[model samples]
Target: MKNTPSTQGRAYSRRDFLKLSGLTALSIGGMTVLTACGPSTETKDSGATDAKSDTASSFGEGGKLRVGMEVAYPPYNWQTSEATDDTIPVEGLDGAYADGIDIFVAKKVAAAFGLEAVAVKLAWSGLIEALNAGQIDCIIAGMTPTDERKQSIDFSDPYFIGHYGLLVKKDSPYASATSFADFAGASVLGQKDTLLDTVIDEIDGVNHMTPVDSVPAQLSHVNQGACDAITYNVENRGGLLAANPDLVAIQFDGSYQLFPDEVSCNVGLKKGQDDVLKKVNDAIAAMGADDSTWETIIARQPA
Candidate 1:
């Protein structure tokens, strides 16, 4: 299989693609429960030492921290064959698969705790279930620590901060819209089960659009006049705009709103995995002290 960039402009090696598709098939063939209910606790610290010890013991022999992520997300995780000095292969992904900033950070955490870092690619909606079932030790998929997610699992301190933005056609009237409320009557959509979908509801009288199956598909919808715009993280929006010159990214200006500072993206662990959570949190804190580390990681990928 050849390593090629995805239609979305992210590199995806053929090996990585086959591996991901195979895993999905295996999961379905076994009738594996792909989705499950998650907790809603907003402020539980489960990444303590005891939890880590327990998780380590559960995984047996080698102290490997199995991490689940969506390898398709660039600047965080993506597929690439031309291994650069910084590219690291995802554990289960094949054909020179590697990840971005988040994977780099996960590597630091794994090293700090003397554990092998293993990456597992899973759908965003199924991440929590995978963690709870021990399919993966933790989730490092750039998932935001939200109040709704806290009930199902615990999260480490935020490692990277980002906010949402709207992606629209360059010449679209909505291109100049700033706030979430600005799209009052415009049709908007986002990835299913993501904050983007739920966040749109905050806008009064907005014509909420149905969620799409993937980021590329959502963008396609906007391109085909199926939707006015799609909302997503600024980092991803940058990648999208870079890949597709016709799309315009609408920055929130001062209108961008996140769930306060407390709710940020972090590594997620199962409810009882306190020890593992603490190890990850401490590693993140250490990483935070070095601004250059993040700068270098960000500079390696497209946009």
Candidate 2:
């Protein structure tokens, strides 16, 4: 992967995906269950004392930028058994590597701090706790900096900004929807504990199904006719539509639009890491105009 210079261009819309052969998940409470990334088979909580206190910041040992992610969300991040110049090794999963836009941004941020990038695989719910406990230095997963999250950690400027949409099977009635109003009475599904889930309320008369833990799970439910559609980032349409030829995205850019016009994907850091935050922000600022680049990244997702 190459380092794209930050120009004054806009970032792409949001991202999330994947299905692990041996999937794992953990239950969390409140706003935590709804964050952007999904659960992991791995536990990152080590019960360590708080690494952050007194407004001070510290980096990991050996000049490593220990960034944490679910390592199961594709287009954003996902695990692979094979290594590529585009991947970073998963800290605990031997022979496994993580690849996606998040990994790309993590490397640039690490470079800005003169450190090597290392991927720490963690449950989506455990990222913040892990960061605060010194288990990891920062989180580069595809997380939105929701007001609820700001209470626990500070975030850098957005690395990716995306729009939300719905995915339905090609033969489904919702596939013909051109406006939000067209989906009345249709059942919809979204990832648990994510904006994807909450957005279901935006549709009038729509049957909002219980939230699932991952995009892949949402996909499964849709395929099985358990739901009419699944919420997703419109920017991911290319890869997903290509991979699941049976699906179509209901992306609106005109009259009927995504409830949230733009979803931001930002970096989460433990509070008080002002210096590190600034450095990471600077790296993000240098990553100017990712509109097309991100599409390229999406185009390359493993099928």
Candidate 3:
């Protein structure tokens, strides 16, 4: 049976029920009890219906691929209602929906595999945990493949490469400083537990401010003169710069020792799901070698 719009949105399936029954049997013997109490004609009909439902609910049968992401991040993921017939509402974001680089790219990747794209909103830090828990099949959030994360999950080929930058107030002296060393005596802030925060700590004489809860908060501290600047990726900083006129991005050319040139961000999957990982990676590679996929996703955002 073809998946209609209504059926596509719901998460019910006969296969899922069967899997549930099997698991229930192992834990509670519920299936055995139901079978013993269901020898009637009605039971047989119900069983057949359930079996057909399970077969229809299989992932590949409906041509759907489940993807998880943090819709709060812009340029990568965000909500919109403009609906050019190109975007769809996320599974559980209420009136909000996700679009942008990640969603667009995810749609393309899903299409390449003959799968329908379904977006599942997830917290940034919880993405990996959700993947391992089977809550999500893959994470298309704009996540960097850090060494720490590599130990738990496998990442796809780098689809986008971004550089780090400093966001500061328009009038701050450090606004014009291009190199990390130039902030030797200035106060800096960044999102807590992120690469930006760690990198800022390496600057000599730099009074690093307490880590902020979010990127916007880090930008707010700089705007309020709480810190000289906030270190973050150019993509995120770009959004802040566009939203706050008083903020300026200080691009460090070759001055601030390059952190790493090939910081490739890609989809993440649960470890040992090599088959699914290979399919996703191959889809990314076949879409074209150009980074326009990233640009296209980013272009859908406000800035």
Encode model 3's per-residue lDDT on 1-303: one tens digit a residue: 111111211122323322222212212111110111111101111112222322333333456666776565556666564455556567644555567667766887788778877776655666776666565667887776677788989877756555455667888887777666778889988776456677675567889788875566776687788888777665444345556779776755632223433234688887887787778777776655343344344444543
Q: TM-score: which candidate is best? A: 2
Best by lDDT: 2
Clashing pairs in 3: 14-53, 14-54, 15-54, 63-116, 101-297
lDDT of 1 by residue, 10-78 (tens): 122223322322212311111101111111111112231122324433541268777777666655665
Tens-place lDDT per residue, model 2, 178-271, is 7889899899998876788877887889899989877777877887889998888655555566556687766554312256545667889989
Give me the runs in candidate 3 sitting further than 4 Å from their true place.
1-63, 236-238, 253-261, 289-296
Report the poorest 10 consecutive residues by lDDT, candidate 1: 32-41
Error of 2 at 84 (Å): 3.0
**How does model 2 score by TM-score?**
0.79
TM-score of each: 0.73, 0.79, 0.72
Displacement of the residue 39 alpha carbon in candidate 3, Å = 50
TM-score: model 3 vs. ground truth: 0.72
